[model samples]
Target: MSTEQPMAMRQIVVSSAEDIRVERVPWPDAPGEHEVLVRSRLVGICGSDTHACAGKHPFIALPYRPGHEVVGVVGAVGPGVSDLAEGDRVVLEPNLVCGKCRQCRDGRYNICRELAVFGCQSVGAMADAFVIPRDRLHRVPDGVSDELAALVEPLATPVHAVRRAGVGPGSRVAVLGAGPIGLLCLVAARAAGAEVVVVTDVLKNKLERAQRLGADAALDAAAPDLVDQARRALGGGADEGADVVLDCVSGQSSMTQAIELVDKGGTVMVVGIAAGPTTIPLHLVQDREIAVIGSLMYVHDDVRRAIELLAGGAVAAEDLVTATFPLERAAEAFAASIAPDQLKVLVSVAGPG
Candidate 1:
């Protein structure tokens, strides 16, 4: 007699801003070709998820499921999937790209003409069980815990931005935020051999965390002479500047600061999503020939590198996971994510398995 138990599923749905519901859902059937069934493990609550819950995210539609930073265990694989199998730990790449798009043809699928995200654009993995394409699942190394593995999605964003900025040995980098993305960016930059990393944030606690996470210096963005402080941290006087400045905050002021802090002809990478338009010094950008680059969400290779970084202990992902709630308390988890004290909040879907 078969010992397998009957399948069950539950999903958290965001009806609107401040309206979240947990409902019993029908168990998803076996996967189709090119798809795999995943038993959701841990889902990290990102700022975008909270914005989507508040109905404020620019791209996320209403009445959608809201989890993209997800980790799980593969429970079943369809006919076309030959690599993954039952009980394999995995993380989802989330980006669904149309292969025929011009960007995808050029291997830049993060900007595919017809791109859809898993949680934001389609079904999310904030459930007891979910189905995703085989290509979207990346196996997690055995040494990485489910919680840490869940962070690969968020970490991939900075990996792409750091790579785009061309961080190399002895490079000087300034990161203008200490939030999850900013902190991860610091880790990525340092791992890429950046010798001088100065991080600035409005909060002292975040700055302290940034220091612990390998930032050579942490400054308060609210200081009157914040630019001077950052420059000093970078070992540069007022006239000297960084080789690259990463605007992880991406606000009007932060973008302006990024421009001011980078050397002439240096690179400035915009990683964060601003609330709206932020005026900038276009004249200075033109005069100095600063390479202003905008990094989109990760491509497949970025995800692979994120996994490598996490597995190799380049980033202490678990240190950022300050809180976790059960699937039944997802709303509480979302609320906790916005709290000032929490760094990364995760929902325990199947409780570590």
Candidate 2:
């Protein structure tokens, strides 16, 4: 007769503002039907995670697990799962949706009426091992590295936003914010044939990073003549502005600047989650006929496109992921994520795949 100990995994949770705790929970049981057990390799700390950690995420309540951006290796596949097997690398889509919702039925499920994110609204992939439905996992291409795979979730948002704004050949684009999402937006827009891309941020280091990522121009958001500088970089007349302005910051000031820097009949894709009610220029929006669109999470097509872009080297992950921490130091990872100097902070779970 032999006695063995059950396996346990470390799960990170945010109980309150600036409070992150790691709890040891029993390893998940063998996945049920249509589910796959995944061992996390890399998990990213996104803006939403930072906001949630600070108790400012309007939609996400506190005491939630904190990992949505994930790259994992399949440990086991439940019955009825055929496409995936142990050792397969995958990226999590993270959006939990209700199939009966109007948006879901209409094929726009990213905005399901009762949409709940995996990490925000439920148990997330911050654990060393987790079981998830097969539908939520996308296989990573053979050539894609773990770093790039970890970035798919974040990149998908900008892909959806760019598609929503219809950025195409010769279009002039100005992205407000040099964060991960904004830099990814620049990459997506340029790949979609945007003639020129200008990025703005308050931090000099972020602006410099954006330039390195191929921004035609990087400007100081605090500059009094920011609008003028953007217009000049966009190669237009004094009165003209960019064809599309993506407000990745989505703060009151950035919202106002987005409207001010978009050409008449253009679109403003709000990619960032606002902390609270933000007032934009209604009269200007009405008079200029600018379409202010709010972009939420992405659909699977966006995820597929993000994979292709990352795999093809269109979206470089080298500079975007500035810092990485082990699972034991998730608290420090969250702190670094909110740091003004960092772009994307990752928590190494199972480490390299």
Per-model TM-score versus the true fold: 0.96, 0.96
RMSD of each: 2.0, 2.5
Q: Cα lDDT of model 1 overall?
A: 0.87
RMSD of 2: 2.5
Q: What is the lDDT of residue 346 in candidate 1?
A: 93
lDDT tens digits, residues 1-353, model 2?
A: 11122477789989875689889888788899999988898999999988888888998898899789999999888999999988999999999899898899998999999899999999999988788899999999999999989999999999999999999999999999999999999999998999999999999999999999899999999999999999999998898999999999999999989999999999999999998899988999999999999999899999999999999998667879999999989999988887898999999985321
lDDT of 1 by residue, 95-137 (tens): 8988997899999999999999989998798988788889998
Q: What is the lDDT of residue 287 in candidate 1?
A: 100
Worst 10 residues of 1 by lDDT: 1-10
Model 2 ranges with Cα > 4 A deviation = 1-5, 351-353
What lDDT is obtained when candidate 2 is compared to the true structure?
Answer: 0.91
